[model samples]
Target: EPIVEEMRRFLDKGMELQRLVPFAEVMAELAWLGEGDRDEALHLIALAEGLAPTRAVFGGLAAWRRLLSPESDPGETDGMAEPHRLQLIGDWRAAAALWARMGAPFERALALLQGDEAAQREALDIFEALGARPVAQHVRGLLRQSGVSGIARGPRQATRANQAGLTQRQMEVLQLIERGFSNKKIAAHMAISPKTVDHHVSAVLGKLEAVSRGEAAAAARASGLV
Candidate 1:
């Protein structure tokens, strides 16, 4: 927790200096990453805004609050920062792509949850793989609400229970391969990029100990994995 301690010190210093932007930034981080409640965070953010009402210093943080707060208006993302604006306004696919480019995997998956069924499933897979059970369950609930079928009804199984460790997306790729779909076809079917499909295919082959797609499919069938 050294990082948290350092951030606390930074927050204290920002407050001491009465620096509007830094104070707002630290308050926002503490609000999200610390035990600070939503109301408290908003109050602190408002205090920072009061310091400089005309500045757009806390637009991203405000947008983040709106995105995470169920009661907040979704269309209140005007003049916010790029990815946060996209997320707050429900432009999730664009938000997801931006998060990916920013190397933020969790945020990317979260943005994906607001997309279509295919994207939601991909987000579920990422959450499960990351051991984020709460968010994964939330995603499952979303899928169910959307009438998507064949969703898992419980927590992720232990790693030892599924020795291959293939993610949900990878399993889908394996099933498609078993049904004789090429990587390009699988990508088209899954609504993902061809490069992503290639990655999934490669992961499936590695997990199944197969040198070729056919071999992987056969092994999956024989192992009752498909």
Candidate 2:
């Protein structure tokens, strides 16, 4: 209750700042917390929908919320609900790919948990590797509930390359920048025009929140991204 009240305040602050994503994210987290509290969950979902630019593209957050509705409309998402439908029918492996492509990590993990025993283990491993203690515990509990066992606790290594949400070409350009290459040199290596490389460099810098190439390169190297 206290957390809910605090989150409401945070939501207000985000609104005041004209930043909608935090409101949507907080609503998603609240929805997840409410779980079987359908009324509360739907209320949170409505709030998120108001903040979201569209019914899509808070990635799968809106889709996940839509799944919790008592009266579902398959047509509402324009076939986007197919993944959830597949997930419901024990075809979660198919759904997992969609979630992964959508960059929805939580949805991907959920789909994987329902896919198969190996995939369930994989979901747990992913949670553990991310140091997502609550989610990992939840996955482990789910396995125990289903009489599943023998999950190997392998090394926890989350790939950080392009973790700044960089595209493949941006990642390549970033690596070159870290190696002290100029735009022309990077263009020659990638066989693209210098103008294209400049765009990518600017994109990479913006994504990394760096003011200059040097700072971005230093950040990439420090974060093991380069």
Whole-model lDDT per candidate: 0.66, 0.64
Q: Give per-residue CA lDDT, model 2, range 9-80, as digits (tens).
A: 676665532344454445454344322244555565555556655434433544455445524542345333
After the best TM-score superposition of candidate 1, give how far the Cα of residue 123 lies from its true spot, in angstroms.
2.0
Instruction: Compute the lDDT of residue 69 as modeled in candidate 1.
Output: 61
TM-score of 1: 0.45
lDDT for residue 180 in candidate 1, whole number 0-100: 92
Candidate 1 structure lDDT? 0.66
Query: Model 1 over residues 142-225: C-alpha lDDT tens digits?
Result: 678778999965554665215455666677888898999988898889877675576567656765779999898778877778
Report the C-alpha displacement of residue 117, candidate 2, in angstroms. 2.9
In candidate 2, stretches whose alpha carbon ends up further than 4 angstroms from where it belongs are 1-7, 10-24, 30-39, 47-54, 57-59, 66-75, 79-91, 98-107, 149-226
Clashing residue pairs found in predicted model 1: none
Per-model tally of clashing residue pairs: 0, 0
Least accurate 10 contiguous residues by lDDT in model 2: 29-38
